[model samples]
Target: MSIPAFADISKSANDLLNKDFYHLSAGTIEVKSNTPNNVAFKVTGKSSHEKATSGAIEGKYADKSLGIKGRVYLLLPTCHPKKGVKLNLTFKQSAFHGRAFFDLLKGPTANVDAVIGHEGFLAGASAGYDVQKAAVTGYSAAVGYIAPQYSAAITATDNLSVFAASYHKVNSQVEAGAKATWNSKSGSAVGLEVASKYRLDPVSFAKAKINDRGVAAVSYNVLLRPGVTLGLGASFDTQKLEQATHKVGASFTFES
Candidate 1:
């Protein structure tokens, strides 16, 4: 097993609680296509009841060790066509991976990250430098161990003010994970979240998660066809169930 990047140290647990849940107030649609020349294209459109509709177009090309990706956002109402472009370059090898990102819209910022793994152990760090301010804005470091069926990681982020630890375990049909974080600067309460995913069948799965903030969520995903997937999810405020503030969302994706 290969260790993930610093930002992805808790990816398994985070994905179970966040990805495909899509508990937005509106709808989202995504389309993807791949070409024989190793180029991939994707378009995503989202609708919001409180704001105008928005979309983005992304393209990527990759080979054995190098990859490049670009995306342009379509801001509604008044779109600045050129300012929304973002670019990313990535390189990967058996024991090392690196990435660079450029955001043309926000401070026209650039960030870089690198990770190295060997013998199931990993170490990585990331830094973001603000081009406008000409100073290092933020940085983080992480260390972890990955195995065939389980993984553990610890990280210090926010300029070392926040520390987090996570663990994930997987079996044939069940996946479970937990994460905890504490902020040294505030010396406040620790934040905790746990999630689980269960494979209902070969084509479908269910996920559920809860946090210390009295919030809970559940989601179900099913493959309707060979290249089509559907996801439905809902979230609730356990402490204020009578407030009628719960949310439900659905998402559809197609790939070819």
Candidate 2:
């Protein structure tokens, strides 16, 4: 198995809890196209009751022989006149990978990350540098072990004030994972969450999760066609069910 990067250590569990859970108050549509020349394009539009309609267009190109890929994004409404564009580039090899990002719209900032893995063991770090202040804004490090059926990782971030650990496992028809975090600066209780996904069939699945806080969520996804999918999700505040503070969302995606 190939180990993932520092931030992706808990991707399996996080994706189950976060991905495809659209907000009921909002609507989104995305279109993706790929070309034979190793280039792709994506356009996304979003609207919500709380905010005005917005959209973004992205273009990407990849060179498999050189192990390099690049992407650029143009945000709708041009958040910043001087820095309205975002850029990213990445290089990947068998044992190492690195990425750089430029988001001038926010602080005119730039950041870089690198990861190295061998025999299912991984180590990596990332740092953000502020251009205006000419100072190191933040940094973190992590290590992880990945296997065919299970994976585990630990990381210290937020200038070493926050620590987190995650573990995931896959079985025949179910995948389960958990993550825990503690903030040394806050001196507060630890936070924990566990999630699981069950495969109903080859084309459909269901997921459910709960956290230390009295909140729980469930989602279902199904492939509607070769290039289309549908997703439905709902979340509830278990501590205040009588308040009717529940959310429901639906999403549809198309690709070609």
Candidate 3:
């Protein structure tokens, strides 16, 4: 293969790093046009070596209860050596004592899910099967019992992976949770994670997590404006102090 230029190599490296490592560094811009009625349009662009852009048009029906969305993407030169599309539909309805939600996603990999819940209890199941690849990519069923003071759930996927999690409301401003997961294919012990969230006030909150791999992270979020928010996050490896990462991100929303 021919050698690549230094600038080209650097750009490609940054593109991959930003895309996979940190969204804050990806340089993404999104614009949603002000429109009337139930129809809306949005366009987004990301600066990377690949130079990717996408456009989406969505519509609401049934008194804004039903939504249909479609997206098209363009990656200069190539996107994964191929071009693809995604279409999704969301429907929500009042069910039992709470609500029911259904989502259908069609794209390179197709998936569907349904969920129903009331106040503090929710049950969900989802499946994703790729016919062209002749593989089952996703399968899981989960049920959660949540109360004002406690919550718990367990999930199993394809009978190969299992996960369990629980949370407790410590007080009005603080909550704590723990999670455990096991993957049969990896032959690893159950991964454990302990996490907590604290709300300093209505506009600011903080989160921290420590996982089985001796990796820990803390993040804080604050609202900068009515429709704008800012986040700062940092992670460190407890076993290796030198292995650490930090990220900063800002999000914006516009309404007519």
Cα-based TM-score, every candidate: 0.85, 0.86, 0.59
Sequence-dependent TM-score of model 1: 0.85
Candidate that would win on lDDT: 1
lDDT tens per residue, model 1, 1-256: 5546567766765676567666664678899999997778888888764555877777776674543444444434454455455778777788987889888778889889998999988899999988988999899888888888988888899987899998999999999999999999988899999889999999999988889999998888999999999988888999999997788878899999
Rate residue 55 of model 2 by lDDT. Answer: 85
Instruction: Give stretches of model 1 more than 4 Å off.
Output: 49-52, 65-78, 84-91, 102-110, 130-134
Tens digits of per-residue lDDT for model 3 on 72-140?
444344446653344555554653222222223333466666666666566777777675676767677
Sort by lDDT, top down from the best: 1, 2, 3
- What is the per-residue lDDT of model 2 for residues 1-256, given as tens digits with 9 covering 90 to 100? 5546557865765676566666453567778899999999998887764667888999999997977777777889675664356777767688887878887777778888888999988889999988888888999888888788888888889887898888889987999888899999998899998888899999999988889997898888899999888877788899999996887766777899
lDDT of 2: 0.81
lDDT of each: 0.82, 0.81, 0.53
lDDT of 3 at 205: 80
Query: How many residue pairs clash per model?
Result: 0, 0, 0
- Alpha carbon RMSD to native, model 3: 11.9
* Of candidates 3 and 2, the better by TM-score: 2
By the TM-score metric, which is better: model 1 or model 2? 2
Best TM-score among the predictions, by candidate number: 2
